[model samples]
Target: MLLRTERQPSAKRSSGRDTTEKPTRGADVMGKGSVLIFEQDKIVRDVVSSTLARAGLEVHPAAELDAALQAFESGKLDAVILGAASAGDGASELIHAASRVSLEVIVLSSSPTIEEAVAFVKAGASDYLAHPARSPELLGRIERILERRRAREDLRSTRQENLKRHGVASLIGSSPAMQRVLNLVDCITDNHDATVLILGESGTGKDLIAKMIHWSGPRAEGPYMNVTCTTLRDTLLESELFGHERGAFTDAKTQKKGLVELADGGTLFLDEIGDMSLAIQSRLLRFLEERAFRRVGGQADLRVNVRVIAATNRNLEEMVARGEFREDLYFRLNVIPIVMPPLRSRKGDVPLLVRHFMNVFHRELHKPVLEIEPALMGQLEAYNWPGNVRELRNLVERAMVLSTTEVLWSVVRRRSRPEAPSEASFRLPPGGVDFDVLEKDLLSQALEAARGHQARAGELLGLNRDQVRYRMLKYGLNSPAPARGGLALRV
Candidate 1:
């Protein structure tokens, strides 16, 4: 007959077994997720419970089926370990019950067999462990399960945060041109499979719109991958988009999954798609048409569900006319077209954007809030922002960094009289100059003038920081390290 004893403070078991063994290293790091042990054998149940309890798990041990089910239903559990002998005929039923609630279940059997393991696994058991379960193995499996649960929780939390951060409400514009873009986004947020093409000049927030669609849409929980087509050449870009098998090329050492495969059930934002070579364009078109693609060296046509969103500052229609871009691919991507209005065209929104960015910079830089000068606001609104919203944002950040008082008087006074150079300022040489050399020389001089500050260098030219960096990289010009105790401005 079994005798039940009251729970003790020490590691002494009611089954007369000593469970006072020291827990292995890293055992206490098993996290706070709870585990349920359902075992009929009093000795096994007591031992397993003690092991897990020592490992820092909130373990609930039960000798009866009814008691186990009661505890499982009453509390939240990350995993449930069942003894096959104790469960007997009800093993499958219990597995189904736990699985229905999405709980991880592991079956423990004394006389293990492939048939029984397969049956239990088919019945929704996460794993099967042989009898006399070793403490290390048991704890290792439980730790892995808890680790996966934690990762999934983290992903869910991130998805919720992205939804909040990139939602339609964060778009921050109500002008008629922006209203039209918002309406299009609202209509397509529910359509997860449609291809979207965003067209706008550089720095017009095309990337922002793509993110808004992904984070606010039905597939918000899935991954969002952004690839700049201009950054890679044809062969490299092809392998990047379609993956490659081992020995596919000189540098192909191991099998790799591409962005398209990793972005399965999600969105893949291809920026600067106009720069993609014809070879890559052909492959991309085929994937769009068939929803399947072969890896660089693999013969299998793997399929994935990915929403392609292509954005470019260049005019694809003109490129098609010039045979620079594929007409078929352009049509496929332009199914749901979105044209972002230039910031100059929406000059009425300048005041709103200025104030919004000022607040954003205030919080980011931890600076005291400064009142916007009326004259500065007038100058900003009247000026043509060739670099669009990005330039405006950079200007605000720069001004905030340079401000010393509660008012933006000094920066406003300096900005009021803009000294923009005209086209006539640059004279063409009698012998036409090498454009690349001229560009590199100008970039070098600007960097020197700004004291190696990329953003300030960009301000000297009409380019944004990213454009400056890209050109600098193209010209193999490395920026100098920032000096200590220098003003830290946003890039």
Candidate 2:
């Protein structure tokens, strides 16, 4: 019973094509979906029918509310176009009847006032349009409504499929850190339109977290669009987010709808927003404040309803202090901040994640059940995961694809060691080496080579995890290391 409106329609286009013409397009004659049109006035009915038919919709014109209700009860109609001006006292009844069938109802009136339109919307009209309906605008509104309905249908099906594929669980973790993340997700399910900021290191599943929030919210039926901020230049990114009008710039041939407009009534995920330039950040801030923007080089302001969800790996607080990021924009986007804990910080979930990946890859590769060697599991649990979950998934996938044996130890054992150094010998010139600096540099290299796994780093230096931990603390390097003896990796 929600309501939406585009604008008051006009009968003539700038090109002077009569909005009432029966479209000659072959596609229009063979329209794909049926629309039930109810209008007592013959002229208005013909005009509305012609416009709908031209948009490739099959129109069933009815001269009375009873006929329209009968057609609606036939259950073949995708939508209903009601001429409220002609229906008189029966307009509300027809709207209610259509809503009962879950059919999208669009109300048409000869002279619709604000109060009347609001009344019709409250009576269950999905959209309200006043005569004479412009052909392009009317067609566009109908198509948009249909598109949103289809998107909702698709979302439901996809959710069901995901439930099956994901073992009826969206996020997997047993640790208290992970439990907190789940709690945060649960808390945000009902707050569909709030701007959300997701902070996480690369490969910690920020994208997945964003999707979870969108799908769990009330606007799940609406579109979910994402823009990767770091991949495109500032200008290109702006064009992508706020499309340019034809002839706006060089190579601009036609007008395009931006992601914000396209994601109406849905969520727009801005991935890696920290990478956006200051100019783009200001533009985004304006859109958030006003809920409207003009296309690049276009004069008219276009309004759209879209919820913003932003994600980034960078530290915005530090960036703000350093004058690299806008402080005001950060506050606007940080309305509801959800930080994703890095995989290393949730070491207790490593085994669970490994099993999940193993099962997924095994099924995908059509391989038998994977056998984990205890030593290999121990090594995996003890190592630090710099790349987070993504790296772990890649590791499991690579092992599944390359190794013939069911046991994964031999396939992945080599990765546990730090990469070998170059063959070049180091020699001091006239100056003596600074031992403290040299030691810190070696520690950094070993940590990097081991992919931040302190235990493996210590192994490279012929020291234990404890010794590596001590050196890291001495150097002011903070990274999680394997606990005393580390968690036991199951066979």
Candidate 3:
């Protein structure tokens, strides 16, 4: 009975029903919702209440603003329909009160002009409906508003869940070393603009640590951009960092913004920072000091708010001592230094890491690997992982991808080591041997263990291939051994 009943025009009584429109059922217009009606006119109030009740909504009718506010507070009202004629001077006040509690307010007017309707909307009215409106129009508007509110709530919940998964829980380790790292991260997670320096060897998950800090901080909603300093040349890297004006150079056809500008109010991660040239280091230092930078070929200085997180596997102290890295930049970037321990140092957490990766790849590959062979697991834990967590993850993925068995047993094994003798089984020579000779012997033994592959040999010795090659050249081992993949190893 939403539409007005049409029989004949009544000159004596006002029914507040539209005679031209046909009656429509409220149930077909919208779903059930809670509504509060505030109106002083008896006929108008009854009409609205009846329409809403027939529409399957929980309806509450109030004669004055005070009673309306009481009902609004008592019931879980999704919306409020106020008659401006009866609301009179307190119409705006009622609208504001409903808004404070996040309740949607709709205003009904007898003769609302365009400006009056606009004013009501500006005063926090969700919608303004003129008198003599159809019941379907009112119910549809309320349905749409409730639908949008539900959508926003659902989206917010999804974002919070994602933040929890990637921000803190992704670190994943119970070892003492990992616990210390987590404690450090937790302390500074709220400091959005603090510079964080992550120190670790390659593949030690420095990038992961940087992400954890950024995503857990206040700037989590902002942009995050990661750049590898060593991957770009000096000139290109400069333009990429500080942007460039149009006609600045041969390739500068149009003005471009840099990572700093793009990452405003968020974080900019500079990986392999030890490889950055001295010139870029000077520019970076100025930005850190002043929070401003001039684009290439541009005279204007642009200011930006950004958090700088730097990571590197190289030894910065040694580079500073050699005058290759700026000492001032080193101290500035190291405001909060977090050291990521290599995987070999935390052997006790190997099994946990293994299971974590197994679950990850199993989901990705859609394959079930429910168990691990004890022998293979023992070998994995015993091996000294040079590439750290990255290497271990790759090893697990490799085994899972290639094996067809329900239980994983195949493993990538490193060269076997000769058994070490007990302390009592060996006697020191009368004249102690030179430390250099022993070091050289160990280097040669590692080379033999790797079967003359410099890369694998370096992994065994905890050094890179370049360092191993330099050592071989110094020891006068010039004969090249046969190797695959264009690798020439000194025999």
Candidate 4:
């Protein structure tokens, strides 16, 4: 029950308005966000409402539980101030109901007890306040709660924006291999703590996959920090990953937080993990296993909630077999594996990728959209993309820059052609060569020369179309050949 205090006499208004009138819904409202004062006692309700209203908050005072619930259900309220007297037998029920909608509920009681407060808090009350609560204290607590809510809303908005920019939707590929990768990403995007290892060759967009996993997942709002393992030596890399205490090393003048520490409640991307030295691999393995690490020369072990997304082009299994990498760490990081296929293996996606890049570059460089030549796609798909998507992106950007006319053409032709093997330079090695290897090399060269035209490739190799096709299948250059007429870029 609330304290029964007499309602103070209304003071005269200088503006000739009635001061005794009750505040109606949506009246005397200001812009600091709305709150409902659900108190049965009119005097207490009016007091709390006036206090909050004076602080620039819109107040909705409800004397009945039904009215309070109706208002709470209909309005965008920052919080609900639930009076125990008004709630009576359904105080806990009301608290739980508000909690289900993520609405903050602050319980007010005349005779506040520790046990009651604990119970209300456990029932999802944001706070439990005593009757005749100090105006400043009540206002302070409400303001703090509102501030936290605003911060969370802001973080959620940011995460949504990042998802739009770096999510799996941004990964453009329709080939079967790319579909597999997308399927895997969808499965793991909501998983917050798994260790993911992305395996692919350089320029295959391994880093892009890492970003997609971070920004599209539950950890989107967390800090995403990436470091290339090959960029630093073992000693410096250790300090960068696990921080250091002051005077830990010659350059450690002050205490520093490493990428792992800084990425707490987020993600840490370790690029080129295969290049990491064996010594550093040991420390990394321990950190992965324990989720704890000590700073250099620091005795205290610090723990962080960070998801480690590691990527590498090197074969970790072979490295482990050769003792260059820790087998334990490989197993730990490989918990969830995503292998990005090389572009040549998925040449069907080349046209789609080319168009995506063209749109991207047009917006970035503010260049007019250039018409693509029909033959360009054929040439692009025919060549073995040693640098993968990154190479393709660069080629598109370069072509857009150098192309003066509206129609994009002949950029592939400008690439330095392989010089023909001359009789003077051709030498049979003293040890002799593998015939299959020589034949495969010649077949690959002829295919490149013909831009993947079977008959044309046969002309270069002095073999018929069927012979060239058979050799191509044997050498695993199994990309479909262009039609006899020509190849056109398809969507």
Candidate 5:
């Protein structure tokens, strides 16, 4: 639960040119990072943890530095905060223990004078926080430490991936949805010859799955070809998939190799395979049925060594029923179907995804790591991702670029869901003349349902964001009753 300050000091607004916001979650830092408040004073730990949580960090508090160390090891922390003088007599040993376990250390003092802060920094503390705390600076320090961790891991990963390793293992979270995906990838690893079709909506990371299969497979050393069916014309696609002989078409002035030939001894990924025409599907089916294909405008048949991995956002079964797709070809490609879950379906992955995007944006823009406010994370989990993982990725990337210091709650809140059933289809009762009366009724109904959450309640009503605000003014609804030392949102 969020512990708000009693007798709260109105948070002083900063006048700096840059508007720093609350933090958002960043990349995988290996272990669960927890802040251990070792101050024996209950009030001290409360204040520290409360401050940390307010800044949007995961805090794990212990009264003793020794106990904090134990918890650190037990919880597998990426970093640990040893509250000032809280370690008692074993503070030095505690610091060493932290480094030994590869934990980044931050030493915090309630009354850290200049000398104390310097000494602690010199003594292997990645950060030294002087106790009369400044939320922004402390947040900045934590962000820096996390970024360093990401750079180190990313460097290690780059080296491994250069050797053809599947690297999405760095993506964290023990969500069952993620585990199922990993399991499916494992199943596809041993079946290089078996045709695999990855089915998912856009942004569901079908491309990643295809690459993971290729990189993890026995054919990791071979070429990997990617062809997007939607991006190519039918004639061009045929020439692209199969080699073209000289004078085959106006653009084909000379003999040219196709994706299949280029991908010889490797993996060929056909994205948007459902977009392939029936004629092209027939050719592909023949190749899949008997690993042989003739070049465009050529009489000779050629056999090539390659593994085909097809991905599509379209429902091929529906297309087959409609005669837009060949059922025979669909049967040939469905040898090993791997269906990806949309982001909305995997509630456990939201935190991991937040961190993933955080790390990504922090590096891309060279910004500090930001902690994700719990409130924001909850909002993310509650929202349905109709566009799938791709949609989530885009939102995150945009947030990273546009976000200031805090998680971009405005963007999250501003995001509009797909339109509901059209109002045009629903006729009002006879004599629907009073517009204000109609609006007041709809607004009252929604507000009652959401209990004064303007955003959510607005979604329940078939109205754009502006319309909701305008109607709220038209009705007698307001913000939640204010609580002392908490959010004083405008009604």
Candidate 6:
């Protein structure tokens, strides 16, 4: 829970409405934990800091980047809040640094452009809100982060005895992004029967992430099922997902088991769920809310204790805004969200993935991938992986096929961008060419070289007759070519 002693924003302004009448609590509502606020705006900082300090959370607000980071690393903060700044500012970078130390982060800024909001979340911020937020809203957001953090910490404690490295395609990296994801998974495993939404760009290994969650979770003893949202048509999808009673439809000759049923007491991974049709989504939403489902043409509802983990490349919030997805359903499924980072942002993990891939392909295809060329490594790092990890894996395999030697660079087709400008044509001799003198001399020489024929003169200069004439006109160079192929210009 949030430290509640802070003064709630004055309700006296808006029709004398008080936001919170609840009793005061400390930042350590769960225990004795502190909060940090980093901001340069003195007024905003003071108001927020004072409010939190009064709430009993031990709020420490820093007014500069260095000071903020110092205080961040210098203490064990339950959460970090960064106040407002304009676009192209260091706000995102500041959040990133805070992520390394704090379990939860909240950003307070003005209403941002859609791109800015996406960028903020992508940078590891747990949540963002407009600055000068009401103390009630601020406190609510704080508790969410702190509560989630404590949940994760508890989850980690439970996993300490049995938690092991990710199996097969292990997510190998100590990057802050990966650490948070791991922490989220730890939390998921502790809480049973809660729906988890795995949000990320395609090819960020959402499936692998789901498996990791289930394998380490309380449901590890149960089966795991997968349902691709894009594959089935509307009616078929519904019948298939919820199972169909005998004679439910023309093709439903016998009773069938649903993916949800198969996944009972385990985890159900729904991939590309953002594409699921509204009709099916409605049914799924009911199941999520009631913890039970009714098969096609069945009057009775069947209860299942299965964890629903969904993945999608599309922005569900945008879909909801556009009226394509249900807003209520969106909120229900987003209970515990885990956003995966793209491959381009974490270049440090590239080598680890390369080695892991090499070992897998070596045993299967009987080819050794002992070394990668430095040039190729440079190329891989330089290229923006629009397709993310899936593309990277495919490219590595393609390189292996074309490799005669253990050298891996030749298979990489992307060229390296030039490091610096060097071969431009602008630099000339100390004494630059005299435009007038050179024009006259070139006219005379080209006509002579062409034997005074206009067409031939054009050929000598590697240009068309019209092009030569146009240049001559622009340069004010007029030299007549004789019918016998000789021409000259007088000084």
> How much lDDT does each candidate structure score?
0.83, 0.78, 0.79, 0.80, 0.72, 0.72
Best by lDDT: 1
lDDT of 6 by residue, 262-331 (tens): 8998889999898898998899989998889999989999998898999887789999998999999999
Q: What lDDT does candidate 6 reach at residue 193?
A: 74
How high is each candidate's TM-score? 0.74, 0.60, 0.67, 0.76, 0.53, 0.51
For candidate 6, the 10 contiguous residues with the lowest summed lDDT are: 1-10
The 10-residue segment of model 2 with minimum total lDDT is: 482-491
Cα RMSD to native, each candidate? 9.1, 11.8, 8.7, 11.2, 25.8, 28.6
Better of 1 and 4 by lDDT: 1
Question: What C-alpha lDDT, on a 0 to 100 scale, does residue 85 get in candidate 3?
Answer: 85
Considering summed lDDT, which 10 consecutive residues are worst modelled in model 4? 482-491
Best-to-worst order by TM-score is: 4, 1, 3, 2, 5, 6
Candidate 3 backbone overlaps, count: 0
Runs in model 5 deviating more than 4 A are 1-159, 162-165, 168-173, 405-407, 415-491
Model 1 per-residue lDDT tens digits across residues 1-491: 11112223343446876645676736458858699899989998888888888888888888887887887677588999999889988787778778777788888888777788878888888888886766777787888888888888898899888887788887878799999999999999999999999999888999999999999898888889999998888899999999999999999999999999999999999999988889899999999999999999998999999999999988899999999999999999999999999998998889889888889988999876567768767777777676789877877787788774333344345445655578737666566667776677788778888999987788677676777877887678897433233222223
True lDDT of residue 326, candidate 6 = 93
Regions more than 4 Å wrong, model 3: 1-158, 404-412, 417-491
Residue 238 accuracy (lDDT) in model 6:
89
Instruction: Give the per-residue lDDT of model 2 (tens digit) for 1-491.
Output: 32334455444546665544544444543357778888888888887787777667889999977788789767788788888777789987888888787788888777777888888888888888866666665676677666766676787898666444432156878989888988888888788778999998777888888888777777776888999987799888998999889999898999988898899988899998988999999999999999988889899999988889999988999999989999999999999999999887988888898788878877888866567767767777776766678777877787778654333464246546565575555555455666666667777777877989986786566555645765786677786433333222222
Separately for all candidates shown, the number of backbone clashes (residues 3 or more apart, or on different chains) is: 0, 1, 0, 0, 11, 7
Q: What pairs collide in candidate 6?
A: 3-26, 5-55, 6-55, 451-485, 451-486, 452-485, 452-486
Candidate 1 lDDT (Cα, whole model)?
0.83
- Taking the tens digit of each residue's C-alpha lDDT, what string does model 5 give over 162-202? 43434457544477877887887887787879999999867
